[model samples]
Target chain A: MTNTLTDYISGYMDTINQQLEQFVYSLQVPERLRDSMLYSIQAGGKRIRPILLLMACEAYGGSPNRALPVGCAVEMVHTYSLIHDDLPAMDNDDVRRGMPTNHKKFDDATAILAGDGLLTASFFAITNHDLLQDEEKVYLSRELSKASGAEGMVAGQMLDMEAENQELTVEKLEQIHKHKTGELLRFSAVAGAYIGGANQSQLQSIEKYARHLGLLFQVQDDILDIIGDEEEMGKPVGSDETNQKSTYPQLLGLQGAIDKRDYYANQAKEALKEAGVDSTLLEEFIDYIQHRKK
Target chain B: MTNTLTDYISGYMDTINQQLEQFVYSLQVPERLRDSMLYSIQAGGKRIRPILLLMACEAYGGSPNRALPVGCAVEMVHTYSLIHDDLPAMDNDDVRRGMPTNHKKFDDATAILAGDGLLTASFFAITNHDLLQDEEKVYLSRELSKASGAEGMVAGQMLDMEAENQELTVEKLEQIHKHKTGELLRFSAVAGAYIGGANQSQLQSIEKYARHLGLLFQVQDDILDIIGDEEEMGKPVGSDETNQKSTYPQLLGLQGAIDKRDYYANQAKEALKEAGVDSTLLEEFIDYIQHRKK
Candidate 1:
């Protein structure tokens, strides 16, 4: 079952990655900028956001192919954020995905524009997809903007910068991560539900699941930053601490962090239960986040 | 009459600027990122893009206020490009709108994030607006995305980057500027028409006008870069020459550039005439662009 799930998810990811590359290429990006964008995207993260989006769509009885555009859109938004985050002004990290960051590989301006390009491309993807209704497309596009913009990831990033060198409570940390990272996750699930024609109540349930799943995803990330090997993680470890940034492992002890992860994981499963839909794949994803080493 | 037109455009801009500031603030932008975005937006340009969009809408008998969100959206996208363009990797300019650029004022990372935030917020603004039918909103959103994304402004920018220090002919320069700078201008007009429920022929006429207007806009900009006063322009003159960037004035002599501006300006007015709409405001604006100092 685990292997089958992996195969299913991987197959979906491959389709998404392929279609996404084609979309990016169709933009006719100049050689240099194109190279920079491809550098980060092709650097090989797990395509976690896209996978979640596709899974949510599938769970709601939508074809993964139909959902592929949204999957690509979410990942584009995610990759764009990562490019900007790795800039000299933000995380200022020299490496990501075990390769030189976009800014490091290209110039900062190109990296900045590449991020802008990706973010802008995401809107086009969601809006241009022919299979979705106008209302569905508009709603998804709106939700995406809410997730990626100031009130969402950008605001969270601002808070993260300010909170650096200062201690933060668990609640504050959650607030930061929820916006910086969680909002997009919520958008992915809710958008999938929307495009799949899920009812309002069903969407609400998916939101609950996404909310918890997003929190757990970040927590696991924090844990990995501490415990995972640098080679496997593909970026420097303990840099979060080195930068004086707050994290779950910092607020909660190692054991406390694990407990929190379990708490959220259970909450996610409960939300799925409320959804009253078969979300076995989503459940497995939650479990995977809790257990993944890298 | 000129004063009345100026008042009309300026009043509309003042409303948009106020609304833009408010809309951005509504997102809970982190203090740092918020400061960066506000600094660029409030730094003050001519507000030409918004004014053009408003005039187009008004020309078609659409309420300017109803079109205000689209105005703000284009300006946000424009401001984002300027922010990213000033980064060390791109144009490396130290100033814009008479103020230090975002990267200089904040940091490279903050500037990049601010640009990212602003770009995402553009679409968010359009989607969240109350005016327009659901179908219209979706169409509007898609058009704006195409204008801003890889196929449009991004490609233009990529071309700009590639052409630097290379031998670019007048035709290539026009092609690059058409997408890089003109596409959004075209969008501003098209968006207004879309909001106004323009018929196909009306839209085509506006498209023709916009293409010519954009060409004239760029030629004038290039002319200003060479001959305009530093104090009047609010940035150092001749930076384009210093950077060895290609422009109309570079490819064509000064006299030729001026002639091109006039030719395109006349063509734009003619297109407006062909549209059979009230051309009073648009005509005045076109004349203003032909002779304006900044």
Candidate 2:
């Protein structure tokens, strides 16, 4: 690895994967369910959600160890959502990150239970973390639940499904992605700030930064689905078109979508600057989001 | 409606139902998902889990209002489990409470998301409750997550699915029921005690009482599946036999199962008596478990 942002991300990914493995293995579930869950958690991703959490915590002067459990919890939530979204009744995808989707590797029943198990375990992970105070634990758990529950990610999915093949304005598209992808990302950033004892103004600034970054992430994903390589992206391109789901490029056109992504990225940087915290890593993260091919 | 235990239960049931209605309605989910979720929750069961929680709280001299949120939270968990269990990949039941199951009424995808929504909302309900201290909220959320997660109900369902069509020993059958049904019941009973400020010995006694009661409840369910009226039960009898599920009545003879039910009911009463708490409503609950037609 070179001394680039990619190298830094690679290091964080290694640590996050190790922590996730230990956490899932330590659960007292049956062997089959445990194996099924471990399969997906170990199936790799960028580990963006958790890494952002740790970086935010450190930038706000909290030890990364104190926020590590919350990071794992958010990752579990993300993994479980992916497992369910790829189910036959949902998006019906057969592959994720170049590996078979959970329902494909395990049966549908096991996959569903695995998702449920991970979702449930996320709360346990939050509450059982030893380093955080009880107050922080309660607040984080509540926020995570709200982000994941009917009002947030689940509702976003419902709307996305309902909006399939329908003409959508950019506003409606933003609403869908904001709830589906933004809420948990927002929670990740804000929770770390809370744990680090960030002031009210710092918390608000970090939340704004996360909101813009989340939108930028989704818009970039929309652009990638149209133009990215199949092998690098680890799945077929044009899935959004196949699903007839609304996308940023679909609403704003290709050039327009690129401009939107850049706009959000700049807004995110501005928020970070306004927050006036250590921004070296977060700035790198924003740049990575801007230029990643996959 | 008299001052008898039956009337008291009826009152509690009404209050719980209303609270559940208000909570689901207040959620910011899309209208369709909200309706689907409300449909399942409004489809009535005995509300045994939430009722047990409230009764235990009152027994420990805590006002039931203080524990109402936890009651609703447990009920949401139970409702979500039922929704998932009725999926085509799982139990595949089409009818529940004399109406279409969640998946049958809605689509499979909607049902899955609805279940996920409720499960996520459950933790939110626990932590967002205003009356409890942060410590109690954390403890209760952790307990609920453990009871509902892989090590508990989800694991039991997996074991049950795997055990189908295979002859299960009495020991294995006990293990399945203990995780599948007993853990949530145990949490309900013990959480109330904790919130109501029970002493250590009192908590133990209630936990023991709840364990016996949980097993007794399952044994009776198995017996009812054989002999109870479908109209009263609101679903077909003999589902266990149809599914090739091992039940107490299958592992032990009918008479033996009945004897086991009586034994556990008596043991529950004994534990309650030893605890030296108000036993009027709890004793009635045990009797109800023994003799209810549904």
Candidate 3:
């Protein structure tokens, strides 16, 4: 946790939060729906996705200014997924990020609409972005739709629900997370690289880095669910065990999961090195994901 | 309707339904999730939206083949909206188009995922379509997002939910439908025209046509809900009245609503005439919307 790295993240987090708030508030939507959408955006997460997007863009020697709105767009989609995942019919969680979930705060209908609004607006955000070329916008939309839709996060969600109370082999578990988290994370890196004018080869290297990082994130998340501090996580731990849901820890042992997480972290660093990207911040991210309490 | 318009519609309808099925079935998604999506898409409506898109494209001198996939994309979004609207937390509908709703056939979670999948894939479909220019794809994606997102359909859905069981003046009611049905209808015509290479002036006239056509669709919908035959509509009539939902017929007397419908139809026809379009098919559409039993 170098002060410089920490400072960098904090600075971008503040900017991301501010811009996201402005973006949602400025929408010409029903006031109540806008509020619900803004509420979740403001309900704090680490803004890891958007920050990663910006860092990846910078690593490719592009200006962060160009990536800013695109980063926010990814965050919007991510927020929508979380809100829907917390619905009574889904994960049924009443709290997220230390606050009442959108459904709990505004009711299921509002939360649903809010999620819909956010997801639906994200493509517009990208295409309507003035800084990017029209062709760049097309690529982003195509990749984004893949990352968020049936082929990606949503499919992962559906499979995860089906897997609840059922045994999942390690292969099946990895398959789930690859789509669930890996694809979006992959998009964060690859999209940034493309927008940064990286050639196809550079984009491929970044994709490799992101795939490993995504697994590292999920493995750590699974392990943290077993032993994470309740106060730090803002929710009770051991939820996976309670729900009879499979995790890397459950499928393998806890120590085994820890070993896998480190392996992914190392693999991610190697990919960054192979690409010869500006790896200082991404290397720190490897450490941060490896050791973060939440 | 003239035989030319009738034959034209039936011919395109077959191709639309066929390609839509192929598109959904071809996705490399989970079998169950894909099936759920296919179920709703195959659960027939009149394929009105896609057909309108095709007709508008042809009217503006575009080939139907080029507009085919984009039309499918619009229909996919429309279908997804219906699936989400039928959820237990939303409309709680049991049947649509004479078949069980997506949520009824599948569980709530699967239905949600299917809707999410369809909505998300639509952008990909547009961007991935080979026939359209990059510029056209960008235009369609931008318009689709606005039409489907917070500024449009989702906002309308949220407002309609809020207005449920509450008194709404005709102005408020029109505002809701304009956002709800209006934007998407506008997209169909406008996107088709753009892809067909219609100039700015032609596009504006089509926009006007679509605006009136959207209201005509809604007004007729209200009338059908009150007096439509169950067999003809393929669902029970009076459900809106049963739900105590606001409708044009409720806001205005039945005769007033009928007058409104005819007026909008006339206005839509005038717009088409002003656009100097090949208006034979669209003229039939205005009539079909006005007098269709369903």
**DockQ for each candidate?**
0.74, 0.92, 0.89
Indicate the residue-level lDDT of B184 in model 2: 92
**Proportion of native contacts in model 3?**
0.88
Q: Count the backbone clashes (under 3 Å) in each candidate.
A: 2, 0, 0
Clashing residue pairs, backbone N/CA/C < 3 A, model 2: none
**What are the per-candidate TM-scores when only chain A is compared?**
0.97, 0.97, 0.98
Q: Model 1 compared with the native: what TM-score?
A: 0.96
Off by over 4 Å in 1: none
Over A129-227, each residue of candidate 2 has an lDDT whose tens digit, in order, gives 999899999999999999988998899889988888899999999999889999999999999888877899999999999999999999999999999
Error of model 2, residue A258, in angstroms? 0.6
Q: Flag the better candidate by TM-score, 1 or 2.
A: 2
Q: What's the TM-score of each model vs. the native?
A: 0.96, 0.98, 0.99
TM-score of 2: 0.98
How do these models rank on TM-score, best leading? 3, 2, 1
- Candidate topping DockQ: 2
RMSD of each: 1.9, 1.4, 1.0
Q: List model 3 lDDT by residue over B16-71, tens digit each.
A: 99999998887889989999999999898988889889999998889988999999
| Model 3 segments more than 4 A misplaced | none
lDDT of 3 by residue, A1-294 (tens): 787679989988889999899889888999899889989998889888888888888888898888989999899999999999999899999988789999999999898889989998889889989898888999999999999999999989988988999999999999999988888899998888888778888888889999999999999999999889989999889888888899998888999999999999999988888776778987898898889999
Q: Candidate 1 at residue A47, lDDT? A: 85
Worst 10 residues of 2 chain A by lDDT: A1-10
